[model samples]
Target: MSQKRNIFEEVGEQKASTPTPQGGMIDQGRGGARRGIRAWLMVLFAMVVVMVVVGGLTRLTDSGLSITEWRPVTGAIPPLSEADWQAEFDKYKQIDQWAIDNQWMELADFKEIYWWEWGHRQIGRVIGLVWALGFFGFLLARQIPTGWTGRLLFIGGLGGLQGAVGWWMVASGVTSGEGVTTVASYRLATHLGLAFLILGYIAWFIMLLSRPERDLMQARRQKEAKLWGLSTGLLHLAGVQILLGALVAGIDAGRSFTDWPLMMGQFFPPEAFSISPLWKNFFENPGLVQFIHRMVGYLLFAFAIVVFLRGRKSAHGATRAAFAAAFIALSAQVVLGIYTVVTAAPWNVAIVHQVFAILVFTLILRARFLSGYPIVTSIRGA
Candidate 1:
């Protein structure tokens, strides 16, 4: 048998024989999905974002609790005939919310809620189909590199979790003594929270994958820590603000106490502490919930301002740009929120306000990576 050469030495010889590109010894290993699950995650995740924004519209229109049933398989095809429409309405009529919560709702009126609820479910069905198709395509195309099966599994698993959660949220109002119960605010928060968590991670995966496998040794330790800190903080604060906003929604606080300089004509309403011995109002009371959301919003704005100023002198262009964007977007969000409140939470204005929260959440993450990581990467390269 011919002698087998050492594999490491063989690799060295092959490396020496292969032509190096013009830039002294071009890096051979690039283009890794080391960016993680991003390339495949984008399309599916983008649709999820659409689902969320539209879901917000659905909530504002009071469409979420309308479906009144959890028909996963058969319900996929909506009312195809007039008789079918009436049948759907009959099922809806049995709910307490129909008769008591919304008195005098017409049979024709039933069709209105039917469509919004229909659209939401239809989109979910599409998302489920797309996910299945994407999974099959990956198996056929063989684009999923080794060791990444787990990640994709997580993504798909979470997508399934979302479907179940959607039902769980809607079901909360199903048995209400009143008409189709209004969606619970906490459940609403949980659903939105999971959607953003997935969205943000996919975006980050895309951002990271688009980058080269950098020489991160210098930053290999301390730098990632700093970046992680700033990034996680930004994410945490944004999430908290969103939760407060949900609390406001749950209490239907936006519709109550509609003045800016004063809620019910006082610096702080007597109702702020009207709930209990002391602390219960911070979470349970509508007036206090929205008011605290407003105050926390101001704090978030100020936090962004301070972070951006610190980023400007840090010398990383991406970090600076991302921070700048976050600050600007935060400012716009604050303004939008103020407008939504003062204007009594118009559907258009409130939806826009929520949309801007996603945009700002994105930029905050972008800046988090920009923070000391770039400089650390440069040092490692040297």
Candidate 2:
């Protein structure tokens, strides 16, 4: 027998229960508790992507040295008055870039370059703010995934270092004499390499969080070990190619040799090691830097072919498809590289090349992720 319900109660009326994680502990279910954190990571990802593009533009337009100082707090405000603008321009005049290269530039002309560098730095500030607010908010609320706090912290640490590295790169050009108009190629490469690394790290984190933690752990059991190694190798090789490309950009090497298959009608460029000290040639010798970039591109493509062939052997269709996509992207990027060289690395074409590089980079990472946690397919198809 059951007790009678109160007559005043309407049909379906009952006490509402509070929804919460089962057992009062943070659960790692697919739809549980971590979506907000994932969204925050995605916001950071988008901001960084914009920063990369803006940074590329900064270099392409020769605007990186517009600001003679690193004013993290005060620099956010652009030149407000004509006097302020003149003050900024006067400072730029002291640098070799203005002294030797841009001496003809008037105040109006200076402002054009000034905005590019300012925009780049402002994005950096926005990213740091977003990270700080999100990280602390999550930590205080106990919303961070178990074992993930340190990973999030690492991103912040890298961002902080990136600011310093950016300054270091700019300082190279600023402190040099009239002979130098840009930062050292090696330092530029270092700066770009770090940006790519940070971008890759954020991407990997997003991929890992796409599914529940338990799913990833289970997927590891079926990891394609060989494919993983192959993809990892491809990632490393691609990274080297990117740094080499940066070197080419740093020294305007792409313009030095407009011919693709051969440099100045020869397989090897002339005066490749003309710069004395020998080691300096790698960074200062435009012909030599461009030659290395071209050779590496060829090697990178060959190795990609090998990786693709091995990838086709994978039992998982999705894994095989990922490699196929990566291969296609690599092929397109190779063509773009050749075109960029032939066109003498015009700003528009060169920027497209850089954009494609980002695509290929991401696709390679995707293939690696698939190799590690492949999506199983049915006998019929994926």
Candidate 3:
């Protein structure tokens, strides 16, 4: 009261000392090396993509059965001497693939297929090592963001399970008396399906890590729930189509009917259900499997159209653009599917189609992510 002054004095003239309130945990530790974790995930994503392509080529070349055993650790060391090569070839000869299909394969010819399977396995080992080193390294350094440990560990666990499932797929063909020249079609589908699942997880995590947790939390508040739901449905539909495509590849079904708009000049192939027990035809019959795959492809494209239309209504420009890109990818994928079929599923064309499928998948995932956590932009759309 004794220090009263003029009432019209400027407000800035007073300076009261007050403590600045520190933010919560996220602002304290720089969010635990998010950029570093994201960089590591990007590397893993590329490796998984390569692994899928190589695995496809391995299947396309009929080289998956070259290695009869799954010596996860020991198998990393390929044959160094001629004797070791012969030993591997000897194992290959015991399988029905040798007795029924490749009866004329010489030791030299055997080595060709051996290298494909070996390379595929070697890539897997490298992926595991990279994941282990990056994960444990960050873990020891305490650089992993909160709530990410379980997510990282889940990917590693899936990688391990994929290895086991891969062996299960190969074991189906390593028989002496079943006249089985290829792995079981369902098992092949399972293996390919798991690969895509791992890819999806890696991609999701990378996107999450690209931004700070605070931003993600804030963006999530404005999520387009309906669009996200639609995209989620589209994702599930695409997953089924992927599995069906795997079945088609597993039995070489795409090569059986090399026509467009119709299979063998008709709406359906003549011997669609020739396989016995009726149920076996869906998985074992080439004609039926390809027909199913084609039908599903059409359905997926139609659904994609619906999702695309819905995405166009989004308020966020970035979200709309993401969906547009995804739609274009899906369209290209459909064309690629037709081309692959018309060309009899040659390895070269088939691999392109497979890789494009991955592209479409990733784009769709991006669109879905944007729907959930849209990027805020200025009025000028910057």
Best of the candidates, lDDT:
3
Q: Which scores better on lDDT, 1 or 3?
A: 3
Across 50-144, the per-residue lDDT of candidate 2 in tens digits comes to: 89889989999999999989999999999999999999999999888988889899999999999999999999999999999999988897778
Cα shift from native, residue 347, model 2 (Å):
0.6
Distance from true location, Cα of 353 in model 1, Å: 0.4
lDDT of 1 by residue, 233-313 (tens): 767998899878877876588888788868888867666778776776775688888878888888887777777677676
**C-alpha lDDT of candidate 2 relative to the true structure:** 0.90
Residue 70, candidate 1: C-alpha displacement in angstroms? 1.4
TM-score of each predicted structure versus truth: 0.84, 0.91, 0.94
Candidate 3 per-residue C-alpha lDDT over 1-382 given as tens digits, one digit per residue, 9 for 90 to 100: 5777789989667546756678766556547888999999999999999999999999999999999999999999999999999899999999999999998999989989999999999999999999999999999999987788899999999999999999999999999988889999999999999999999999999999888888888899999999999999998899999999999999899999999989889998898877889999999898899999999999999999999999999999999999999999999999999999999988999999999989999999999999999998888867
> Candidate 3 — worst ten consecutive residues by lDDT sum?
11-20
> Which of candidates 2 and 3 is the stronger one according to TM-score?
3
User: How far off is residue 63 in model 3, in Å?
Assistant: 0.7
Clash tally, candidates in order: 6, 0, 0
lDDT of each: 0.73, 0.90, 0.93
Candidate 1, superposed: residue stretches over 4 Å from native: 1-39, 176-180, 214-228, 273-284, 372-382
Off by over 4 Å in 2: 1-32, 176-178, 378-381
